[model samples]
Target: MTILIPAMTQAENHPVSLTDDRGKTIELAQPATRPAAISTFGADVSVALGRQPVAITTFGLQGVPAYLGPEMEKIPSLGPRHQPNLEQLSRIAPDLVFAIRRYTEKDGPQIEAIAPMVAMDLITLQDSLDAVALAGDALGRPQQAREINQRFKARLDSLAARSPGNRTVAILTSGGETPFVYYDHFLTASLLERLHFDNVGGSPPNPESGIPLGYRISLEALLALNPDVILLLPSNRQRGFTVNPVWPYLQAVKNDQVFEVGQHWKESAGPIARSLVLDDIERLLLPDDTPLKTSSR
Candidate 1:
């Protein structure tokens, strides 16, 4: 029942118009039937709205997301999420394009020439929620979009109410010598914070460049923070930092609190991705005996 195909709402009667995160207003004559997803958020939202994208960018060179099922593999790849092949996009001839604001801003004009483009700023939790609603409007599923948003908010509140305590944590990635620590405002960290986990990375020193994902942290700096739990989002199984001389001294390491998470943690702005993230948090952080409602989609 989580995924339903409701009847078309107000979008059918009038031209669909909404401003994207880049502050650019895009108007569609009718609901888009052949949208291209430059970011996974668009694809995720599309599927939730009972539709599939005509084309999509790869999930960090892994190709289309297998978690989205076998159907996703058949979609034409526009290449990497950052800089998709414009030629391929042009060939696909998508009616609309959903792009990540930071990645597509420089090439917005080129994309617009091919089709209407909506550049989304999918950084924070609010950004994700708003993006879903905006995408719903474009896809002509506004009512379903509102229902999804409401369900997500209600689920988030339920999880927060069951938070154990304020345990200090850090979300790290990289298979190399230094691991990148995420900022608190990063979507994953933001979710953990809502679950009452204190992010050791905290907010950035300056807000000049808007919200940053994370920064590389040295072993010495990481040791100083000494978070209670360390979530490792490695590119591969080979974690070079674990072999370092200073690795054993960290509190999380000493207590065996370091956990390796999946790729979903990297791009978790969509409805399905967010739900899976909550599932991971509950499975990894909560005790086996802990009784809580599952958030899996």
Candidate 2:
């Protein structure tokens, strides 16, 4: 028997319609059954809401811990995290297509022709959490979404309780000559703040200095910050052991405080993925001797 569900409004007054990245109003006839997510974070939200999207961008998981599990590896790869295969996406004929703001703004009209597209604004960690909850509400999984949120908050609180002292960190997208640092609304900064860590410096020096949502950075500026801990994004162009090269001589690098985290965690913000990120952050901030508090979930 086929089950039919009606389209649910975002909030009591918000309604069931949303603007695509290109500013087109797309109305949902019903909750999406076959969803297509353009970003890795969007894919995580789809999975968290109990709908495995037919297509999804790829994820990087080189150094993630074991508890996060192997969920990402199981999904069908559409293409690189930021650059998705439009032709492949079109073939899927998804009921709903969720994409990042930039992706939708640039390609929404093209994607909308294939399916109803909704551009999600998920620049910050809080935004990511809210997106998950919103997706869950839309998909009728409010309880599951709430549980995920609680789990993340509990882990973050535990980490904060352990380290009352704040450590100043600088998150950079390492590449080129001048690495770009993420600011307040960026995903990495939001994640670090949730863990009770302070990000050094405020905003980019210039408006043009800000890297687009999913771009890489250089090493020269990274050395200048001399952050307490360094998170490295894996290099697709480099085949072998490509170290930070110059930055390794810096204080943070010399102390072996540099960690290689997955691009997905740093780049994407979703309930399940963010939960995994919070877990990794907990491992990074707290000692192994620190016991896990019983989760409120």
Candidate 3:
């Protein structure tokens, strides 16, 4: 890869100043104590750093992450991550705000009016690592963030070393007749690819947004791909595709390789979520081996 990011092993008294994913310099007099998380990554990183956000965006239908424990539920919710309740957020009066670039870009000025928003690009594996570092610095826990990243990298290397031979795989979502197949650049897909799983969706044609991270596929199209394994990240439990005549004929379905994974597989940019993802992969794919525990969990 590129140059290894130097560890910020100690907290600094100097003003916390860093460029965000939006390429804007966010400077704080000290460090943020009461931060509002408009993105789940923000909430995820904050909790991992031993600090709870004053308020946080919802984590799908599950509300605050259950993995983060029940205490998170007590924290005020800003509704949905994409369109958080700005009025509610302003009332909380947080000192800083962590947000997703794509989701909050339009509301950047509005968010900044209340508190300085550090918009993060939480798409790829590298983005996740960078966001953790940025959040660590912002929250005055740079060292913890650095350690988290190091542990994550180590885990990836370990998983890659143990991954089975280049088996073609696909991360599919939606329970409907037409499933949305993830491109390799998506966080979970990237993790799988790192473990030597060849992603059938490869990369998207339009690189800028990766907007439609997954392309909706017909049963005919899925059959043409016929991946060896299918990791089903359903939006809900109702799987309409299972009843189709073509479903049973697929290689993964016939061989009993169609595994239904949790929401962590979808929103997997944060340290805790990603670590849990590694656990799931190990449990699902490397079942015979004993699960190795790590500080990340």
Ranking 2 against 3 by lDDT, winner? 3
79-151, model 3: which lDDT tens digit per residue?
9988899999999999899998899978889999999988887888988998888888888887889999999
Candidate 1's residue-wise lDDT over 1-297, tens digit each?
011232454636456777877667787887788999999988888988887999999876467766677899889988898888999999999989988899997889999999999888788887888888888878888889899999988888777766675589999988899888989888899999988799988897654454577888999999999999999884854778879999999999999999988777888888888888889987888665645535441
Clashes of 2: 4
Which ten contiguous residues of candidate 2 have the minimum total lDDT?
Answer: 1-10
In lDDT terms, how accurate is model 1? 0.83
Model 1 is weakest, by summed lDDT over 10 consecutive residues, at: 1-10
Q: Write down the TM-score of every candidate.
A: 0.91, 0.75, 0.91
Candidate 2's error at 181, in angstroms?
2.6
C-alpha lDDT of residue 116 in model 3: 92
- Per-residue alpha-carbon lDDT of model 2 for 64-156, expressed as tens digits? 222234665565566754567789887878877777776556676787899877676677666666667656654556568778888877766
